[model samples]
Every structure is written in structure tokens, then in C-alpha cells.
Target: MKSNRYIMILFFIVTLLNSSCSDTFVDDIDLKFCGKCAHTGRWTVDSLDFNPCFSTQAECLDWAKKNGYSDRGCVLCN
Candidate 1:
């Protein structure tokens, strides 16, 4: 019946949408603008590590220090 075909089409569309909506991990991503920035760090659950190659390293460091900052990988400046 036509209803069966419509149901199949709807199911297919829903399947495609769900597949496209999957979340991605941040480490798998790269950028052209911030590739050279030092503030582009990623976080672990317990600590912050420096990512010197990222253009946003300074920003990331600040964010970590203010928000989630820990001394796990920090080098003392003082």
C-alpha cells in the first residue's frame, strides 16, 4: 500500500538525520586560522596541558586557569 511506502521513506529520512547528528570528538578536528596559535589546547578531566601549536593557546590557557585550571602540566613562571 501507499502508506507502507510512505512509512519506509519516513524511516529512511529519520535514519539519515540521526546519523548526521552524531557528535564528534574535538581532537579529531583541525583549523586553518588557529593552526599556529598557542592557546588552542584541549582538556583532560583533571588537568590542562599546553598546546603550543594552536593559535588560541593563550586563550585556552587563560580559560583553563580561570575556569578549569590545574597545575598538572603548568611550569612555574615565578
Candidate 2:
């Protein structure tokens, strides 16, 4: 029916609006990175330790290096 078609169109418009708004909002928020350290012989998740979140990847990497960890990297958190 014409009514059903109109309802579907309205729903589509609302969905588009919501998705666009949410995308912009998410882009405005800063992403956090955490430092991950592991042993040279161990690459498993269980062998890695996660450090506190940093505002930038460089900071996370620097923290790992300063802590005397041989294997270190940064990972996105949250």
C-alpha cells in the first residue's frame, strides 16, 4: 500500500540520519592506545601484559621501551 511505502521511506531516512550523526560523534572522540609487552620466546596472549592507556601510539611504545621489555607494541584499547 502507499502508506506502507511512505513508512518505509521515513524509516530509511531516520536510519540514515542516525548513522551519519553517530559516525561524526565517534570521530570526535580520541582513540586510546595501550602498551603490550611479551617475552621473546612467547607470543601468546597469556604471556603479554597490557599497560595503561596512552593518548598516542608513540607514548605507549615509549613506555614499553622504558620498562626494559624486549618485545613491545601498542594496541588500541576500548
Choose the strongest candidate by lDDT: 2
User: What are the per-residue Cα lDDT tens digits for candidate 2 across 1-78?
Assistant: 999999999999999988778767888985433234323222222114555555666775677677765375565543
Model 1 lDDT tens row, 18-53? 887655744556433333332435322223333333
Candidate 1, residue 53: Cα displacement in angstroms equals 34
Model 2: residues with Cα > 4 Å off, grouped in runs: 1-47
Among these predicted structures, which one has the highest TM-score?
Answer: 2
- The alpha-carbon RMSD values of the candidates against the true structure, listed in the order shown, are 9.6, 10.1
Worst 10-residue lDDT window, candidate 2 = 38-47
What TM-score do all the candidates reach, one by one?
Answer: 0.30, 0.35
Off by over 4 Å in 1: 25-78
